[model samples]
Target chain A: MRTVTRLYLSNDTSARAAGAGVLADAWSEHPEVQLIRISSRGAFYLEPMVERDSPAGRVAWFNVTAQDLPLILSGTDGTPVRSIPFLAQQTRVTFANFGETEPLALDEYQARGGLSGLETALRIGPDAIIEELQVSQLRGRGGAAFPVWNKWKVAQQARADQKYVVANADEGDAGTYCDRMILEGDPFRLLEGMLICARAIGAGRGYVYCRQEYPGAAKTLRAAIQKADEAELLELDGEPFPIEVVEGAGSYVCGEETALLESLEGKRGVVRARPPYPAQSGLYGSPTIVSNVLTFATIPNILSRGGAWHAALGTERSRGTMALQLGGRVKHPGLVEVPFGLSLHQILEQFGGGMAPGSRFKAVQVGGPLGSLFPASQMDIPVCYDVFAKAGAVLGHGGIVVYDHETDMVDLARHFMAFTADESCGKCTPCRIGSVRGREILERIQAGSGTIEDLALLHDLGDTMKVASLCALGGRAPYPVLTAIEHFPAEFRAKLRT
Target chain B: MREQVKSVLARVRSKPPNILKALLALQERLGHVPTEAVSEIASALGVTTAQVAGVLSYYPDVRLTAPGRHLIRVCMGESCYANGCGRLLRELQDRLRVDVGETAAGGKFTLDTMSCAGNCAVSPTVMIDRDLYGRLLPSQLDTLLERYK
Candidate 1:
């Protein structure tokens, strides 16, 4: 008998809720249309999304709105699921089931190669899973694109009995929301991903340090953790892996894994010195696999489909899909799963649907609070980390922020400086003190009080934080300010005595 | 007097108020803690407001108000904002006659902004309680608000 595929009706829960119902209703009662209670995960775009068994793979491609539900139902998607222009363009490694499955459901996950990775990992052994992840080219989707396999291998190699796996869900970048979206869409995937990390890394416990602001994501994660416990998917030496949901009090620095671990242990969320990285000594002096939600989400997908499948999607070094929290002036501002090599223009125009309202796209603040701003002229730059760096920025968290012409680059620069200044943990002199000084320079520039000397001083302050700060939050804090000055030199130079 | 806070806090008798538990307790008691709670919390907890506010604003999840019984969290994050959350918010304000971050006179309706609802393609959507309303308008809110009334 078709299990009715349990559809959760929504507009009550989220777009995902209504989307799932609408998607379920679209399917002919082919012995597989089970409807479940609507979940409260709040991803309204992909409401009523289909389950794991849903052959409606197109759901993974776009955030299907309730209004689009009718078109989605009647819309016969004849294209091969992979070739669907929407999914085809995105690098789906991390967000494989974003639009495809019920986020909160455990059974739905298993139906579509969901837990197959865990099963495979358990069967083939953890070392082999590590090897495959290494070859598959899975890298961290958090701000830093560190290789996942290396982190795991390091954790596995680290001598410890109480190792841990933690998902860095404390995403608080102003123009970003990818981690939140993924959690809202398919939370179990994240839990399962963390579970897999726990298994391979020989972890006894795991934690998800979600930001305090993301109540929905936190709730989704909490429910998913409960679901994981119910299903007994968490394992330790073949036992249930002890993955706990730790709600961060909302420190922007907590997104930095170490700072997250500190907050998780009930301390202030502040940056830490690496080398004794979490891969070595983390989370209460235990070797830990500290990952971003996107990174964790990618694991199950990589495991189910095989690492090579993900590894094949991106450029040689930057493989798999990059989940983009498209923001700013773009028309379709949402999560975009694009191949790593796609140009920003393609992502912005084709995926994002172009500038919003009375606006000529101007500059973008990439990454989060710490990432830099890029001029529209650099829209040609590829989204790959290396390329973005060449263009004077690193694509942090893939937070593509668009500024229409009206947005003052100077103001934006000052705004970014102020944000970082406020968020600076004050742990390091450069970041703690330098960030404040940087804010002053921007203030000086904005007040028409600066000269080239002040501009030089601003650059100097930016450099000091970049090199001297302990964590990426401080290191990259100057990115937006520097990029703003580079692109809109006119704004600062006009105020400068050049 | 603060039953919700008492209930949640009672469970943490022996353990000191960790930031998570404290914030949860605060949110529980006040329905929504104001920005003032951050400062005033020290008096409540025998700590400083800066200490309280630091914890209050750090976590992305804790909000400051009780959304009227019918809470409509409109995604005003960049994606949604660009997708027309501005106009949508304006329309919501027009329909509700109350600006965002505020509850209605009758406590039947509350409108506020969110970072993102994860429903990017459905920009200009509203999440009332847990339910999400896509491509919303001032006119479309009546059905949702009626459920609460």
Candidate 2:
């Protein structure tokens, strides 16, 4: 049989929304052409990135449109497009398989060192696997930044009839897409990561708690699960451990671990008090380890290449790489997997190519709506978990949303409060009421009715909410408001009543 | 609606946790989880109608009433907002003669806002029914909405 090389275009959210599906349909009629549907290249700016599997390597084209099809199909489109310099400089240990192999294509994945981590783990056994993770110095990418090994060791030691592992795919953060990129582009890696975690903890079942807003990700995951099942990749030494995906019902609070479990069990996604943490008793009263998708995604790389190799990359405390999702007013806006020590200036100027042409750099929001806001002067801060905390900012989920000069900080602060108020599960009085009050205060300031006394009240209310709120939704909800007032005091002052 | 709910309920075990799965299945088949369907789901899952209704209402996706012929969900996330989605949303509402959370008169369209559609690269994204339009401008909305009408 003569092999006809395949031309790939990812079926990711960015591509699909841009009418890549229509192009795929149009190209399907040609027998001479093989259009393989793979995942995104992570740098969404280059999508509908068209790649052809050639004798030399995968030839690539950028921003491919319907009109370019004839030129490409005719073999006139030359060599696979060279690696983008932005992507070339990336550390890329975790996102190694993205845009390189067919998603769920076991042969393609296996050829490119896909399941080597799992193989290493199976050979070394569970104790060694846990030790390797500890050596890696990896932390949760799901905003909390808790050490990954701590969670795994606790789950390993806690004697329960059944142990469960969950991947938090509930990426409710506004400007983040790394979780969706991994799930849609390289789903098998995510599954492999989960498998490695389950093996280390002696767990029988796992689930990916994904947000329902992402119908594309959900569909891709279902397809990938079938592919994994067919290959028997999830089975460890004849003990079958199945991984299931549970869709979140459009609640931002559910992104929190406890609320996630509540939603999984068919509840209203309310926050539960700690001490009996999910690590201790979770998911039907069984011991569970709930981790973010990136936390698990990093596991395969750590196990494949020794934990020391992973640990050697980043700062002493925050090891390995971080998948930075650049959004808002940036030129090269997309996902970048870089080492953890890069400064905000390097990320914005070098990787992101600074703010999009006309938009003057004003402020950047790190993390989600609940995350702190940074002024242009604060761009020297290195992107490390501990460093970020010390500097009064957080590297939550590595989502960097840039704002131009025209943007009103007062409006942005109000928007954050509004988002929190709308999404609050009403689990605690402080969060439920505090967020609404904060929104009203910001609104009053915006309407030119707020006094300087109102600023003091806002700060006091923020402090109360920070201490009294149930989970992060309320606890961190004041971050943007307080930071906005602190950093962009002029914006609030200009709006105050004379 | 009861028969439809009963059929979906029959597929899964009559357990407490299956309420979400059951409601989702019902929502997929029927646009919304109707009052009758909620009662049937509650009875099948061994929970009360209020419990089932509470679960449905809690989720932004699962609605009580059926959506209009076309669902226009604008991405209101940070990226989209930065790229002038607020203007696009306002223009869409004005053209449709409806608010953000209401369905248009004569049952043609339902205007709503979503968190993040994961289409950050192409900001100001709008999904009309199953088709998503990205990098949307207020001027282009009329032409885009024309297809659905």
The candidate that wins on DockQ is 2
Q: Candidate 1 - CAPRI tier?
A: acceptable
- Output the number of the TM-score-best candidate: 2
Interface RMSD of each: 4.6, 1.5
Candidate 2 lDDT tens digits, A39-135: 7777776667788766677777777887786677666765554456778888777887787766768788778888899999899988999999999
Candidate 1 lDDT over B19-119, as tens digits, reads: 54667656766776666445334544555667667766655446665667777777655445444566777877888799867777888887776655544
DockQ of predictions, in order shown: 0.27, 0.70
lDDT of 2 by residue, B1-149 (tens): 56777787888654455677777777788887787677677777888888888888888888788889889999888888788888988998899899987999999899999887777777878987766777788888888888776
Worst 10 contiguous positions by lDDT, candidate 1 chain B: B8-17
